[model samples]
Target: MKIIDQNYINGEFKTIDSSKRLTLKNPTTEEDIAQIYLSTPAEMDEAIHCAATTFESFSQTSIDTRMDILQRIHDELHKYEEELIDLAVLEFGATITTTRRRTKNAINLFLAIKEELKSYDFIKKDDYSITIKEGVGVIGVIIPWNANLAHLCSNIAPAIALGCTLVIKPSEFNALETQAFLECLHRANIPKGVVNVVHGTGEVVGEILTKHPLVNAISFIGSTKTGKRIFENCSKTIKRMTLELGGKSPTVLLEDANLAEVIPHVLSSAYSNSGQACHAGSRLLVPKAKVNEVKRLLLETIQKLKIGDPKNEETKIGPMINQTQFNTVQDYIKSGIEEGAQLLCGGLGRVQEFEKGYFVKPTVFICQDQTLKIVQEEIFGPVLCVLPYESEQEALNMANDTLFGLSAYVFSSDETKAYEFAKQIRSGRVLINTAASKAKNPPFGGMKQSGLGRMGGRYSMDAFCEIKSILF
Candidate 1:
């Protein structure tokens, strides 16, 4: 088995001294793949101190210099594309298609940020005074495992663009993938102490990053529960924070929407990343009259999805991250059955063909009750809950009833009507008749308990910056 015994700190790989180690397994085969030496609390402290010290010089870097670094990093990422894709599939159980798309998107983020930096104005002047936006100093970055490299690159690009130093703590689950990414950062020739990584559990490494006084801001993408704890911890120091939390996003099909055209889009959102995405449209809101038609289309589409080893190019669905996640998805499916929701397609247990691995049946449920656990909670699996609404007003109400407002989808033949309806939803991003947004560098975050601040484009830059007014 491969062994990962180093943490990237001060632009160098330092051997981890802690005895605590996490063994990683291939989600598809349930076989041990690698063992990672976890970073200790003292190591986390060293990373933080390195980042804090680096911020003094890094934060003063010129925009052109920072842009060059981003470009170099982007180029370096391209060299590791194949390795990154392979590791994502082997470790995270992501299908090849999903891994390719995620890896591509992650690499492109650096170029996108570089473009944004080209014209970005760090200082604005009026007749009376000049307003300055400076890097927020040492930043603490914590990311989840669902899209390890994507989250890592996403968090890193913005902070780098703003000339902010980072002390990042990625999930221990994707330690191997994280190691590959760290190599990319190292080869990019990033300045010493500009980017530091600590590999350990959240209770250890994460706690230090969250509570450290030297860390000026935090950029985290994880569950709502962990985000809450981080928020509370940051409150003690009153640090700037940008949190991208959980979502139980809704896919609304208006009465006028064409079932043939829209059902494909709906299923894409529902099952993207094998339904492990935080913004997966797990809730499907349909007009009461169209429920039957939607159900038929959903089953027809789901059957065509190839579920098996992630290594297969044709495999669309892969196994869960591990036994814990598999059990969690199973529990949610069981709750749906016990709560009286009709299981239209798929049910409890693995696919008949697969005897091993954490593969869950891609399930769908027809439910009227919005209070059901399957309807209300973030299942983070290939499970979709179809909720029928009698009226458009009711549809809007049902879509916005959840505690999450990260993302929502609206499908209608009438573009104007769909746009109008999308505006009323409380989600941070409302896509009309599309699973993905085409807009460049649009703000991404959520309303209500979903998140506190935004990321992407200038919004991300703002998150890592401190604004000041210099009066003439």
Candidate 2:
């Protein structure tokens, strides 16, 4: 198989003119995997121009034609399932199980979006009034390294279904995976200039796409800080923006909840994707009476999780994206210790056996209260802060205390109580006795500083569209 080293523009794979390139390395083995040719200023402009020009024709394309293209893309995605999984494992240090599941999920997400398009109403008429929903125009998508494939599909599928053209800026860390995705689109015979991928630093290529007058909308998935910058650039042109930013999501366990059953779900929610997820349940709010029992159960479960080589099928936890991410996580651990949070288990540095990879232990800390840094900050790692609350109202308050309202969870034997509590929670999506990730294609996003707008299913199509009313 030939490694794809060029940028996709105008339905063609063109060589990047820049001497600079991004060298990708496997986080698990610390070995070089592939290289992505960095986009030159001219190449970046070409992509934006291609997409802006394509939108004129693409935005008028018939719904059936767009739907067929989506189906084709869906079929094309599965054809490279194994290859995608391998790339994810190598470049992302994703465990075999996680890579397989997330890859399959990413492929199926297109199919789900296709199904949504079938019932979605692009044009509606009632008596003398006509309402139309159309694509927002040329969209610039910036996806993060964590869950890159699924996140890309979440944005791109809807953009295409709504008859919009796009230029994607994938995380440099997972350039190979993004290249595979572009190849899938190319194989699907997507119309030329409809979808393009550019590789380079966010400061350059990202800034260009966001600030370009030709680009009409921006869909960004990354940290809150970066999202704000993107928002500022988009605001200059008053462009449409969809941002899925950071989260310090909380998981609240009620006093009546059984610690044994809920602890496993809590642990999985916090540690999945090695806790690199934006909506990770990093803060665990437990009843004060059950803190000791929760700690004991958490210890037992953490011991069972295998943390090592991502190639191993049994590995549940994998390394951070790179050394910088590893050090960031370690620094957060140090801060938790310094701030007087009790280290219940697992703390600091690499796992003893693995001296080569950027791995960190599945750490747990018992915070003195919600005021602690570990409880308040978005530590995107496998570090869980257990905060004990005195009452249900207090738990709800603690969960809503942060600036991030991305996701929240409540576990209780009583569904009514859980549902009632979930309603008042400040997050965009609330899970009752379940992890925050199980809802597929339902409305997903956040409130407050978690960023504006939503994604998933019909909500996604609506987000990418502009509504107009014609009164007759």
lDDT of each: 0.92, 0.88
| Candidate 2 Cα errors over 4 Å, as ranges | 1-4, 436-438
Residue-level lDDT of model 1, residues 129-160, one tens digit each, is: 99998889999999988999988888889899
Cα shift from native, residue 241, model 2 (Å): 0.8
What tens digits encode model 2's per-residue C-alpha lDDT throughout 298-403? 9999999999988999898999998889999999999999988899998987888886888898999999767777888788889999888898888888888998
Q: Considering summed lDDT, which 10 consecutive residues are worst modelled in model 1?
A: 435-444
Query: CA shift at 235, candidate 2, in angstroms?
Result: 0.8
Model 1 spans > 4 angstroms off: none
Backbone collision tally, model 1: 0
